[model samples]
Target: MDKNDYLKAVDRLNLWAKAYYTDDSPIASDDEYDKLYNAVVQFEKENPDLKLSYSPTNRIGGEVLDEFKKISHIAKMWSMEDIFSDSELVAWILRGDKTDCEFFAEPKFDGASLNLLYENGNLISAATRGDGSVGEDVTNNAKVISSVPLQIDYKDKIEIRGEVVISKDDFELINSERSKNSEPPLANPRNAAAGSLRQLDNSIVKQRKLKFYPWGVGENSLKFNKHSQIMDFVRSLGFLRDDFCKVIKGIDELKIAYKELLSARELKPILMDGMVIRVNDLSKANQLGYTVKFPKFMVAYKFPATEKTAKLIDILLQVGRTGVVTPVGLLDGVLIDGAFVKNVTLHNFDEIDRLNLMKNDFVTVIRSGDVIPKITGVFKDRRDGTQSEIIRPKICPECGNELLDEGVFIKCQNLTCKARVVSSIIYFASKKCMNIDGLGDAIVELLYQKNIIKDIADIYRLDELSFIGLEGFKTKKISNLLLAIDNSKTPNLDKFITSLGIEHIGEVAAKKIAKNYGDKWLELTIEELLSLDGFGEAMALSYLEFMRVNLEKIKELLEFITPKIQNLELKTNIFSGKTVVITGTLSRSRDEFKAQLESYGATISNSVSKKTDFVLYGNEAGSKLEKANKLGVRTIDESEYESLK
Candidate 1:
């Protein structure tokens, strides 16, 4: 390839890497990206003096760092060269000397790399691999990760490198919460882990339940002859090491390990896109040295990209609870990642404009470690002038209300639109909200369709006679549902605020707001809300505007219901003015424990800080316990906590 071709390849690969690593939205398949990257590498090799500094080959990660403080690495972190097929793996193995050399094979974690520093057995710093030589400091966020040890056995300073990842289960749970709040789902586990760890508030990071697995060391006082020995030492220090790491003898064993990992990728707790094969002997690794961006002794063998092409059958508009309308693409039935892909989300109208997507276009759909399938790109080659342009709807499909365009989103402004009302009612009765049992989506829909319930307030007015003739509604069930509705009349202040579904106000924000203002939050002005910590102008304004329009509705609703607000001033007990952090799996739920503590005048904190007076621990208590110990804060077990009560 010529210089111009190299330049173009460089630009293209950078774009793909940025999308893949930073945005979590990959435009190209892994195979295509690898091929382009290899071409760029070849061109750079041919014209060594003309290599560009900003080439994708020389970068550790493509994320833009603005939130966290930047810290320079004591030793440069390196990425591994990726090989796709068996033949390429064999060729890479042959490139190194095979005399008495063994390979250490482990799953290549598909997550963000974090470098941690320990001084005198205490964790001092945690950082991301920003550009190999510098990283963003995320020590506070890392402290909450259960698998990351807050204190180790080593008394000297050491630097351990690990991958911070969210498990598939936790990723799904987080996405489920995001969906409940009408927020866009994270693209994959890797992106979720990165985004969670980079949060400015460590409390948010704690809720993400991110785990860390140590794979290598950057700087250590202790010496080891083999990579496996290093991993063993790290594991002994209470760090999680890859359970699948194996010391294989030759290329055949390496290939076997690769095949096994690739076949069991979906079965693993964490996401692994491939396997990493490294020279086992530490001296041999040093001898092999390093490339500008990758270690010469190791190669990451990526599994084949999982992508399939399916024709776009139709486009459907999904109206969220907040009235934001999203375009979904209906695709011909195709299997991806062992699941049937019938539909993929187009995200928004801006995405439609960018893709120029249309009906009957053959588009590439990818599952990519997420349950929700996404349309990555359109196949222009298959288009034979038969495809029809997707028409943008001028009105809400459910209520016929005129649509309002708000930058990237088009929304239905009708507050009482059927779709919005149904969704809101369901949310208000959800398990996290009023906890009105038996009032599920089907029941809410049935009531709405029958014109028996028009809004959230209507739910409390339903009579048993209204459900007498409804399908599946027996007399006993109707009585039970009415009782549930009555029970929901008195809810916690946080739950009451959360059930309101104010834009950008989720349960966590609601709790924070309630904790500060108690039952008087409605009395606060927008400027006062903006002055509160963590409240931005947009969020504060949205809250004020929502209250302004819904005050009368709220007053009417209050006539039939009451919220139990916590009065911190009334609790003048022994635990008063104490900040308490809870850790581990307690006998009772965390919420129950929190309520019990708050009733005794204790402030609940999610993370351990210097202000923490006590850390209540239970079985399998993690880093927070160690952090409490390190800070010389008192820690009580569940038994001791109960004794106090």
Candidate 2:
């Protein structure tokens, strides 16, 4: 057959595939489609260069890889904030002015998040959403998944981010097959789908029968007025979109939709954690922007938590890193949300007082997913005379010092408390703080017990000889840990502040304080801290007092620790104060060029429009190039762009 015949076969097969997988309307019988597909595959094998990206042959598994490579995302993939109660959802909807807002609601599938990048109408890379900004390349594994489109007509450069899920029936079938093979059943569908995607062999992925559902897009060149338009765009490109996805008008609509979706949650083929509510207006959503952890314009209304009743046996006191004496309840072993619960934190005395919990008295423990269990109710009627009221401790359990009752919390205020010092050291070495990789809770405790590290500052004074005398501290392990400690000397300023574990200040508050003050973060005033996001009077007061008492110690640590400098300055350049659109692959990744242009005070946009000042082009540029030409937007190649820079 000639090129025309091969093209016809490929188009027919792709069309039939889209109809079957996406629209649920198969046009041709499986046998009939297979005959044509096999023929096309044979022709493509004979004429490899003539093969098209959209061909049906790509769906059959064949590719193999030794290991997955890391790739950076064009933009950050922020996770949405979750609200479980109707009141919380209502507050989220009403938090901002929303008179003109329309919301997009879709099932929040519980599966591995995947990011698929396409350029010039072809799938270029597929990755697991690893830490939002970077992911492992899974292009070969993705090709075997039937729902993931290999090509689309509208693509310039776009990233389709979605959930890679295993349907209920498919998951059960897979587990049953494993049982017959005398293999252990997979833990759950979510884990099965996640593990399958990372398998080095594509044949294994093909057997998993995974499905892809596009929840959202990352960076894309196509212009969208509303989020619905983006859904439409992906649907047109042959992705299997959620059937329940709809646009909700207001709070009332959102409330109704949430209830309806919750009722039908189990009916879904794929497991859903909840439903996402996003502002439909693209412009309004962008203006709302994001917080350190979540997008302000969007929220997830999580389904009702898996609540199971458990009995609280006793209450115990523990000292935290900040010397706060917290109450923890000892619960009778109970299972909630697949995990066993033995103990739950009481946070403060106020929580215990609120619940009126007593030792040996039955109390209801509420747990959601991985969130720690809490005492929500006390079975007063079932309580026997043997039950004893929980007593608030008058002295610190670790140091035997008189406790200072500061409203909700009780503190040790003893700088040398063994428990507090050890916990503080652990916090300082944690991933979110200094990120000292090799220093963990066990190592910190061992070091503290040996009198090697008594305080955060003491960590800097430790040497190889300190661990040389200890058992299980191998030479290489000690060397790596020492290197990690040395590396943490230059942690981000926000993280360093968070490592201090102030009573009221957390990561978000610490970030706001650092970003606002930058290099002068140490000089932050209580008045200035009060103005930052999420900072209240109590937090500001706690921050000020902590600094006031430990400023000298912090200064001493600063001699050894240098926080990362936060400086973002726009340079004066020809592209300054201009709107620029970048399309097509360049000599380097688009991210590098975009960062360079942004640093030069230029606004980098996705789509070409009348407002666009310059459209940067490279080899294999697609619709963006054409649109720029017709719109009379100035086009510049690599050399011209270099000249401009």
Candidate 3:
């Protein structure tokens, strides 16, 4: 490649690296990515003078973070030196004195490590482990973490350590959206959570529903210095801690706990990469402490590699939300980390070039515990010279249209890919959008498949004639669905904006845009939109450009629909600004009630508590009701809710 191509490749590599590290979701596959990466590496090696400063291979995750306040640690938080195999771990243990030792064993959670400070029973600060000694303080954002209490029960000044992790359910949900939006899928929950926490916009962080759990302490926090006592004390302070922790008396008991922990790892919520062993006794811990960075009293016991070799059969293209084409690796069947692996996300075109991977190539694959097996490395020696170069589709697989090269991604130019259509339909009928009932993904797909709907606007044109011969469709069901669709014709300004699926504009962002633009949603200039809170230059320009191109089509559709303005007069109503929680089976589905409440401009809390305005109950309410009663929140039965509605 020429110098210009080399420069371009380096720039792209850096962008992908940032997306991989900061975004947690990578746009390219390991093979494709590594190929580009290796090319840069090789180029830098061959012509050292031509190497650029922004090259990805030279960077670490130590950039100065602005989102959080910088702080100096009382003690250096060194990364645990890893031993990948059992023999290596045993050797390390034997390399040091082992007599009179009691290891306090716990799981090494795969999440973002955080350091928390508490003084006079209240949380003073929380920071990420940026380097060893200094970190970005994220105390304000940490306050939103329900697992990390703002005030602990303990009175003494204390510093605790923990990891922030996004739950599997949330991770899947986020990744699904990311895939739809043509963004790279997050590799795992750990990266997903870390990325979410580091987002400059707190609202995005809020939407992520990030959680934290205490794992270690920075300085003296309790009367006891032993690992077991410290854990118990930390738990008592209303912080979530690893549940599998055990005080093992000796190596035999330690081995037992390790086995038990490994077994229990299957049932744990957070991902466990390995087990951490610390001295149980305070005196023993202090005596064994300080070997450069890691405490001699503690060592991480990593699990054996569950990796195996697999053959690259072929590459498949998949379309995402924003029409980005993704490459998926079809591999020879292999068992990895207890799961069968047939396919793995290849990421993007850049990845294919980087790995120098092609069809029929042998690759080393590893399932990093219970997740998908990824091609970590390629075995060039195994190739028999019959390997075929996999071609990335120039058109979208889902919707056959010439793809648009959007710098980082090869996106579908088709405006109506099935995935995009489904997402758009869902968004249009969503609670914060048009608030249509009985309209979800299944119904949307069916409507599209049966040729009853072509777009969101087409939903209004559906009748019983078009609905005939569909699965499980009854007269009443059809009538109700039609009524819901018809009712959704009247959309609110905020809802209309949200339904547009404008880039970076969700419900909250939509509301801000609508309010700022007033009656001139389309008339508002890009500069005007960019001035709105949380609106960036890129997002504003993207929205404006999309609107400018699609405005006429939208305007024509508007003739068949009317803007549904809620009684903004109800702003002064009793429940207007108050947050409410509803538990138990409602007269309608929980989603329905949430929709109804939100329509009237009320905030919905996921959990019941004292601050909750009211807990709307139905038949057979569970612990939430009991908790609400204890907290003295107003309890309203279905009858009361019906009367209010």
State which candidate has the highest lDDT.
2
What do the candidate models score in CA lDDT, each in turn? 0.81, 0.82, 0.71
Q: TM-score of every model?
A: 0.45, 0.53, 0.43
What digit string (tens of lDDT, one per residue) describes model 1 on residues 284-331? 999999854478898888777688989999998988888999999998
For 213-291, candidate 3 gives per-residue lDDT tens digits of: 7777877646775778788878766565555777776556766777777777656766677888766777866766665
Segments in model 3 whose C-alpha atoms lie over 4 Å from true places: 1-66, 180-182, 308-364, 367-645
Clashing pairs in 1: none
User: Who wins the TM-score comparison?
Assistant: 2
Residue-level lDDT of model 2, residues 1-645, one tens digit each, is 789999999888888988888789999999999899889988998999999977878777867665688989998888677777778777776777765689999998888999999998899999998877889999999998999988888648889999999987888788779989999777667778899999987988999999999988888876779998999878888899778999989778888998898888667788887889999998999888886556889988877765667778877899988888989999886754333567888888898888878888777777654456787788899977988878888899898999898788788998778888888888888876788887899889888888888789988887888887797777777888889889989887877888888877765466667777888777778789878645689898988888888899899899899988665344778898788899865655776787678657676787889999999986446689999999999999877988888
Report each candidate's C-alpha RMSD, comma-separated, in the order given. 23.4, 15.3, 26.7
Report how far off residue 507 is in candidate 2 (Å).
18
lDDT-better candidate, 1 vs 3: 1
Report lDDT (Cα) of residue 307, candidate 2.
60
